[model samples]
Structures are given as structure tokens and as C-alpha cells.
Target: MASNIIHFEKDIEFSKKVVLNTSKKFPDPKFIFSETSWKLDQFQNLKTKLNFVKHKLNDFILEEWHEHTSKMNPSGLVVNHVRKHIHPDFLTQAWCKFYEIMCNSSLVSQKSLLTGNMCSVHLCEAPGAFISALNHFMALNHQSIKFDWLAMTLNPYHESNGHPDTVSDDRLIFSTIDKWEFGPDYTGDIFQPRYHEHLYETISKKFDNGASLVTADGSIDCSDDPGEQENIVMSLHNYEMMVALNIIQNGGSFVLKMFTIFECNTICRIYLLCCLFQSVEIQKPATSKSGNSEVYVVCKGYMGRSLATPYIQMFFKSKNHDNALLPLSQIPNNFIDELYNCSSYFCDLQIKTIEKNIITWNNKNESYKEINEIQRIICQEYVNRYKLKPIRWDQDVISSSNWSRARNNKRKINISYSEKLRRRDLCLQEEAVLLYQEIVNFSNSKTNECHEILWGRCDQVSLNISNVKYCLGKPVIQVRSSKFCNDSLLQYRIKIINKFPCIDSLSNSESRILYFKTKLNYSKNGINICDLTDTYAKNRNNNVILQYSCLFNILETLQQKSEDFLLIGYPLYTQIAVACFFVIASMFDTFAIIKPDRNFGHAFAFFGFKNLENWLNILSEVLKYILPRNDSYTRSKLALVSWLPIQQLVKQRSHLDIVLLNNLCIAYEVEPILLSFIQS
Candidate 1:
């Protein structure tokens, strides 16, 4: 009664009779089962017989006798050897077998026979090793053919047993509801009979006719009792078969993963598949571990829907009755009864004994010790292959005491305030040059002909003023003192207003002369004005003309503030320069502010102009004047304000609408009058 002794005197005779009887029934002999034996002499002889018969039949099952022997002595070296070469997880072996069957069968060739493309569907597929296996097989064997695939499984976001069912590999890509290339929608819970209509509709929309290959690796939670486990697996198998039947096209193939063929429901499913397919064979590839009961039902050459409709209807109608069984009387074919008998005999003689041996092995303490040793060995090997050296944080440190002292002394010598100022200025100049180059390069890459005009103007400005340094030597504005209160501030403003001629009369030279005289008189306390005028006439070449109308508006506004403070000798020209820089910065800043809001459509359009060469050239001129100040905070603020608009605009447009508006304001010579509009 030992579990390892599967074929006793009476059972060996019965196994021989069942194999001979089943082999005789197949005319072409497509259906065949390799026999199992317990005795060493009988097992060796059976292997020799299988090799001889394998060449004759296209499909043949290989019985697993080695695992039964290892099960009797659970601490044997054979178990350790097998574990070392392959992953202990059974799914790895199952996927390997699935790949082998697909390649060896005509499924690959037949898939593209009707249509130019091959399409497949996977049901209840998650943690995706099956798909990974298929991908590997196609990559190695048929590299030229392209195929489409769709997959449906439980949503990983949904909670199951306090955790989501998620893939271990993060890199898998396929068709699903959230991430898909082929289908508009995905089918949910194909096991439910009510979900069948949705499933069919989804497949019809995704695949033109139907999928050429359908694979179901679906299973449910099993109880400790073998009978209860068998019942749950059988119920799940029914749902899996229903899906496979509905989706597969004519001449398509199906591979169903199932436990050993012991239960009556498993026999019924096999019989149904036999009636629907041209050939049906059960196979357990070498990659599948010998200890497990899992086997694949590889059904090939699907009969068309017209031929399968009646049988399918009867199967569905049986759901309402007790036991939900498809009556044996309804099957017109004689092969059903014969297949059932063969499957029953094979299970009783081979699988049941193996199952019992597995149970006996599971109860042993040595088996647990052997498994732990195998895992430890695997971990050690993995570490040897992939181990990396630890990073050394102090690698760059100077190890010699003398070298460290020398470096510290050198750093201290270079840390003076004046030296720091010089280095800081040098850094700022380098950054400004780099910024200018980046702007020019971006303009060259993205701008059009209209943008080039603005760039040309920028080039002109840089070339014309390259040698001219606008070093206004601290020209001052006098604030009116309460003690020396005079209406002279009002009188000076009126005098400037009268001298500032109409827009048409004020030529560039005339404007320059008027601004210089006003600045010269203000610095001299509005008294010794003739002396300053004479001095200005002597050094007229040193006075640079401020041409921008916005500059005049800023000067006038500053004059007003100076009068209110009653403070004199403020630097008028330097303030005007800073104000002009602010104007340019504000325009770009406004564009950045409006870019993300949908309601600011006009502002958004203005923000997108691509021709930034004019803007870049103008900014470069202003930065050249500001960089000498060596103020990091101001430089950083200016850089950020200037770069934001350019970055946003570079993606789309190439025209400078804002620049043209500023230019038109200057051309009209009405900057002071239009100061509100410019500021807005």
C-alpha cells in the first residue's frame, strides 16, 4: 500500500489494457498517452518505447515517473539538482511548457492562413509570465511575423486579500482598459455567464473576425480537502471553456491549464473539447515539474461557430439543472465515451499514486530542510553573479596631512573681500556671455524671416554702439528744500516743456541736447546753469543720447518724486537706465503670468511669439550695463524674468508683436503722453 508502488500486480495489467485499447481506437492515432510504471526496469523500458513512438505520432504525452521516485526519498539529490537548474516556482515551468506546445504545434502557421495578421487573447492572465514566455518564443523562433494581443485579468488596483494582484515585472506592455493599443474597451470577469455578451462585443470590436489563439490559465482558491479542491477547479474550468469556445475562430487553437484528469467534471470538459476540435490531446511538458498535477489541454483546429452552436446551447441549458452536467446521451459522437474511459484509467493508474506520494513527501521534515538548502544555494549564486562594490565617500579626500594643510592655506589666501568681488564680477560676465549665446542659438534654430528683421535691428544696435560707453558721471537732480523754497521747480518744468518741441520738430539731436541741458541744470542746483551749459558744450561727446520715449517718462516721474522728497543730487541717468530695464522685464514677466490661464487668450497669443532675437539683443545691451554692478540677487532676478518668456515663446511663434509696439511708441515720439499705455 506504499504510495511509491503505483503499479502493483493487478494495476499493471489494467494499465496495459487501457493503453492498448485507447491506442487501437485512433485511426490516425493522433491521441496517445505515454504509460507510467513504478519499477525501475519498467520505467527505463517505457522511456525507450516513448522515443520510438514519438516519431510516429504528432502528439504524445510523456508520463512523469522520476518525480514519484524522488518523492519517496524527499531528501534525494535528484530533487536538489532539479531545483538548482530551474526556478522552484511551478508557473515558470508551466510557461515554458506552454511555449513549447505552441511552437511544436501548427498553431503559429495556421494563425496567419486566413488573415495576414495573427491575433491572440489571454484570459485571467496577470503577473504576466505566460505573455512573457510567448514574447520570448516569438522573438527567438519567428522574428519576422508581427502579432496583436489583448489581455484581461482582475484589476490590480482593486483590493484582494488586503493587497492588489500586481505584476512583479514593471516593464510589461499589452492591451488592457487603461493602457491599450488595439481595443476601445476591455472585458471584465469573463467567468460570469452574464458578462459573456460584453466579452463577445469587446472581442468583435477589437479583432476583425475573432482571435486565432485563446489561452486560459484561470483557477480559483482551493481548500485543503482534495474533493473540495477538485470541485472548485472544475467549476472554474467550466467558465474557462465557455470563454475559449466563444472567442476562438475557425481552425484556431486553445491551451487550457488544469489539474490531473481525475474529477468527473474534468472528463466532461475533455469530451466537450473533443467534439468541438479536430484533435484534442493532453500534454505535460518536461518543464512542468513532475510533482504537480497540472496538465494542459491543447485543443487544435476549432470547428466553425455553425457546427458548435447546438452543442454550446445544450451545455448552457444544463446550467439550470442540478449538477449542471451536459448529458452523455446528447453527444452524437462515440469518441466521447472512449476518451472518458481512457482519461479515467490514466488518472486512477498514474496520477492518483503520484498525488499520494507528494502528500507523503510534504509530511516529512527532511523535505523542508532540503528546500531551504536549495534556496540558500540559489541566493549565494545570485550574489556571486551580480554583487557590486560599495561606494567610498572619502575617496576624494587628501590623505596626506601636508597636502591638506597646503590646500587650506591656499583657500584662505584667495578669500579676501576685494578678491571675492573680482571673481564674482568675472563669473557674472561669463554667465552673461553664455546667456547671450543661448538666446542667439535658440533664435537661429526657431525663428522665421519676420523674426530675422528684429535680429537684424539687434545686430545694428550692438554694432553701432559697441565703442560708445554711456558713463554718465553721476548727473544729479536737486530736491526743493523748504527753507530755499522757490517756484523754480515749477519754472524749470515749464521751461523744459516749452523747449521740448512738437513731435515733428524734435529730431534725435535736438532731443539729445534738450535732455542733456535739463540733466546738467538739475545737477547744478538750477543755479550756475550757464557754467554747466558751457561745461556740457566742452564735453558734448561724453554725453550719450537716451532715445527711448519710456526713458523720458521715467525721468519725469523720478523728477516728481524728487520734488516731493525735497532731496537733490539724485543720479538721474542711472535711474533712467534701471527703469528702462524694468520696462523690458515687466513685459516678459506679464507674458509668463498669462501663459497658463485659458481666459487670457490674447495675452497667451502674445506670449507665444518666437522671434526673440530683437528681445535678446536689447537684453544683452541692458545686461552689459548691469553686469558691472556685480549684484548676484539683481542678476538672478533679471535672468529669470528674461528667460521665462523666451522659453515659452520658443515653442510656437516667430514674430515680435510686443517689440514692434514698443518701437512704434518710440517712433511716434509720444512716450511721455503714452506712458500709461506702455506701463499697462
Candidate 2:
């Protein structure tokens, strides 16, 4: 026991000596690529020379390290335990990290910055775990802060962004779309110089005094090139720092995610941060998986934007493609030595963990009892220390995106007549005028060469081949959501199918039947009109863009000169719905919006003799209006679609058709109408 104690003390002393040597050798830091070719070669040489040393394991046994951390880290274990019980949005590893930061650091609690208004900007923040955690933290600690936040991330639903590049899960974005800035192109890609400037302007406008807290958790999926992870993300890191520095207030705090900071860019970024902030510390939170080289650089007491300008101009702004920020010869020797020592220390720690995991993996008799005990004790301590309370996820609190779950519960709330009127009224005439102007502009604009011929038509369209009949053109091409499977929607479907027999089977080679049986998820009690309208208003552009993309894809497949489209359960007030009407009107001879279910939106049918030649010629030109552009926010096509007058759409109108559309619109209360309050 005495010998063991002595060894532990010796280990502590050795760690201290390593730190002391690093500090003594390099009192100030420098910018150099300490982790690339030079470091890899050095690591290989040391491994070969010290082959007998058990701690110097072959390669970094990352998988084993993951296993080790999962078993050992109490916070990680607690996260897994509570993940399912709590809302998915609030129970992420990232959530725990923010909570831990709040508990440990003065990022949020700094009294000087906690004035009347507190603002935070979350960059590359998707699935909004950080925001949720911060909300939870504020509720528990400082309820009077009047916190306002804005988040940006790669638009998950963006047609351009694919997997490994964007966060595809869009629950958070869908719920709180208004709070997010998708940049000019609606693709929140900060790596682009344009987005950076746009975001800077947006932050400046929103927060005059600058953000009190700015957190950037931006990272590229470098799984394919793990060895050069730091190098791969150097540009992104620089951009994140630039944005944070430019927008952060004098005493604001910035929390940035970094990994194995050995690259020249990484070193330069860190050195700059150290210079710009009063205190900067590297944190490897317990919530973060130990296998990966993930660390958060917590910077507090920013020395203001003026101090950051020189570094920004010298290193960040300059587009010199050199590997090092400055030549190694020019950098101070002490700084280089410090960088090397720090890098080596982290590398050693990683190697030792890997070696320990390897030993554990080999030893079949290794007991995890100690680990289990530690997890329990630490988890309790963590909860107590952080003062974490179970979050009550209410509608007004954290608007969860689990609409399906809400629908299942059948929860209803009483809303006032005025509120109902507000939710239901969509000014069509106003929207149409704007839409018409946009259409005119689009028609005049030059067509994109790429969309000239939509290459994939058959593959893109969901052709229904199972039930075929020669009646109109082909089998009904049915598009549906899982939400429509309920009995209520099923009845509506039956009524529609019975009324329009040709909808199931189309025999005329010149005609086609497109049926959309969509029933979007609503709350358990029923549709929350307020929630629905608010969401629609926020995502109007995106919805238009999405609809346009889909319509463009389908239009390519419309080989038939005349195509009939049936859109069910769509509120005609939406721009996408209006766009559908416009496209059908442009191609077909007749169009009608009919009521299917009063509870749901409306149904639309467009059928007539048509020729695709003219439509095909103008397809790209017409579609350009819906495409997300630099001027989407200012000259929004959605605004036009939302308030476009329904009357001006048709050249010839029948009383019966008007009554049908009016009834349909009134049934859903989706179109502009004044409600007269009569005594019940």
C-alpha cells in the first residue's frame, strides 16, 4: 500500500514536471503544424523504438477507448439512461456539455454582462441541443435574464446538402424555424465566405451590443480522413473564430469545438484566441466520447473586437495557402517548443488510454464492478453539482417536433375566436399580386442551363403500377404521408376515389392522374392552428422551394401532353399550394379546389386538354421563382403565394366552382374571411 501510494505521488510529480517543462521551454505559444507529417513520422519512430513499452500501443486503439469511456464516464452513462425518458431534443451529449459549462465556467453567470437583455448566437447548431440545455440552465439559475438566441446550421432539407456534410435531423429547425438563419441561399453553410458576411450582418442587426455568449460547434465529418482531421477542419475553425471574434461583445464568452489542435491553422487559431480572451482553457467534457479527439476551447472575457482585428487581418483574412500561419523560422522558438510539448502530452495520454483499453480487452477476467460503482456515485454527484432538474417539455416551453406522438394523445386546448380567426385567415388576393410579380420577374430572368432538361423523370415520380386500368392515362400516381393512414383521412380518401373513378386508373395516353393523399401531423387534441400558421409563415420560402423542386421533378416525367393533378389535404393559402395552382393553370385547361374534410386543409383537381410544348419551354423559367435565391428574404415568393387573390387566377369562373372553393376555404378557414361572433 505504501509503495502504491509512492508510485501515485510519483505519477502526479511526473505530470507536473511535464507541464513545468512545457511552460519553461515555451512561455509563449506559436503557430505550427505539430500533428501532420512530422508528428506522424515522430510517432512511428517512437513506437518502433519503444516496442516493448506497453503504454506505446500500435496505432490509437480508438474503438477500445470508446468502450472504456462508455463504461467509465458517469455523465455518458447518465445521458444514455435519461435519453429515452426525456425529450430527444433535450437529451444529447451536446446538451450535457453546455450544462457542464454553465456549472463549471462563468460563461453565463457573469453579472456584468447579464444586463436587461442577454443574447447568444449558436453557429453550426442543428438539432439545437445547446439551445435546449441553455434554456434549461437559465430556467434553473437566472429566469430574469430575458434570453434571446439565434442558431445557424447547414439546411438539412436543402437539396444541395447531402449526408456527412449536413445535420439531416431537422426536428429543431422545423419547430423553431424563425430563430434560425439559413443565410442568403437558405443553406446555412458557414464555410462559404458569403454566409459568414451575411451572418455577421444579421448578428450586428439583431444584437447592437454584440452577443453575450457565442457557441460554435461546427465540425466536418472527417471519418474518411481521421489522421488529418485537424487539417481538414482548419478553414472551418478559422471561419468560426472569425465570426465569434467579429460578433462577440467586449466581455462576451465564446465556446468553440476543436479536435487534436496540432495543425498550423489550429495552433494559429488557438494562439489568436489566447491573445483575444482574458482566459482560455481547453476542456474535454465527460459527455464527449473519449475515443475521439474532441475538445471545447472555452474562452471568456473577450478583449473586444478591436484587439482581434490585427490577427483577423494577418492570419484569417489573408488567403495565403501556406501550411504554417507564419514560417517556423520566424515563429519564436519557445512557442514552437510549447506547441510540441502540449501536442506530445495529449498524444501520450491518448496512447496510454488506448493501451489500457487493449489490456482490458485481452483480460477476460477483468471486472467492471469498480466502473459501475464509479458511474453511480459520479452520476449522483453530477446531477447534484449541476442542479439538473427534469425538464417539463410543454407546448409553450420546448415546442417538440413529435407531432405524431401528439396526434396519438388526443390533447385539445381552448383557443379564443380572435386567435382562431388569426390562425385561419390567409390573405390570398395580396399573396397572388406578389406571386404574379415574382412570376413575371422569373419569366423575364435567364433560365438555368442545368434545369433546362430535368434528366430523371421516371425515377423521380412515384408511378403506381400495382393497380392499373386504361381509363385516363396510367395507374394513379399516389403520393401520401403516414399521417393519412388514420380512419378520418381514410374516409376522405374513399369519398375522393368514389367521386373521381378516373383517379385510380388513367387510360388516355395524353392524360395523367397525380393524387397526393397527404395529412400532416398535428397535436394530440387536433390541429393547433396557431402553431401551424406560425410554422408555415416561418418556413414559407422553404416550403415553396421544396414544392418547386418536387413539381419540377414531376413535371419532367409528365410525358403526357395533358396531366391532371389531385392535391388533397393542402391549405391552398400556402405559396406551394398557389405555385401548384399556377403550374397546373399554365399547363392544364381547368382547375378546381374542393373540400374533402372540414378538419383538414383542402383538395385540388386540375384536368383538361393540354400541350406540354409551351409548358416545357417555360418550365425552367416558371420554376426559377420558387428556387431559393440571394433575394428570397427581401422579395419573398411565399408572401405572394400566401396572399394571392384566388379570383384573378381563373380567366372564366362558374358560380358552382366559386362556391366549392369558398366552401373549401371556409371549411378549413385557411383563406381570408371575417368571423362574426354570435352567442353560443
Best by lDDT: 2
Q: What is the C-alpha lDDT profile of model 2 across 339-387, one tens digit per residue?
A: 5666565555555544555666555235355445545555555566666
Query: Per-residue lDDT of 1-680 in model 1, one digit per residue for the tens?
Result: 53224223222321222211121121111111111111123323433433233222212112222443443422233234434553222224445556556654556646565346677877776645566456545544554666677776643221111011223121232222332221111113444343444556777898887878888887664422333444557766777787668878888888888865444455556766776787677765433443344567777888876655554555554434225244333333455446545545434444443554555444656655434444344334322332212212232111222221111101112233333345445543353343334334433433232121121121111122232233211111211110111122222222333333222222233343344334323243321101122222232222222222223333343333221111111111222232233333333312211110111011111111133345445544544443223223222111111112211221122123323222221222222312222233
Task: Tell me the spans in candidate 1 whose CA falls farther than 4 Å from its real position.
Answer: 1-91, 109-116, 160-187, 311-322, 331-337, 344-680
What's the C-alpha lDDT at position 513 in model 1?
A: 35
* CA shift of 24, model 1, Å: 17
Give the number of the best model, judged by TM-score.
2
Candidate 1 lDDT (Cα, whole model)? 0.39
lDDT accuracy of residue 245 in candidate 2: 86
- In model 2, the runs with Cα more than 4 Å from the true position are 1-74, 81-89, 109-114, 314-317, 329-331, 362-367, 391-397, 401-680
Cα error, candidate 1, residue 641 (Å): 44
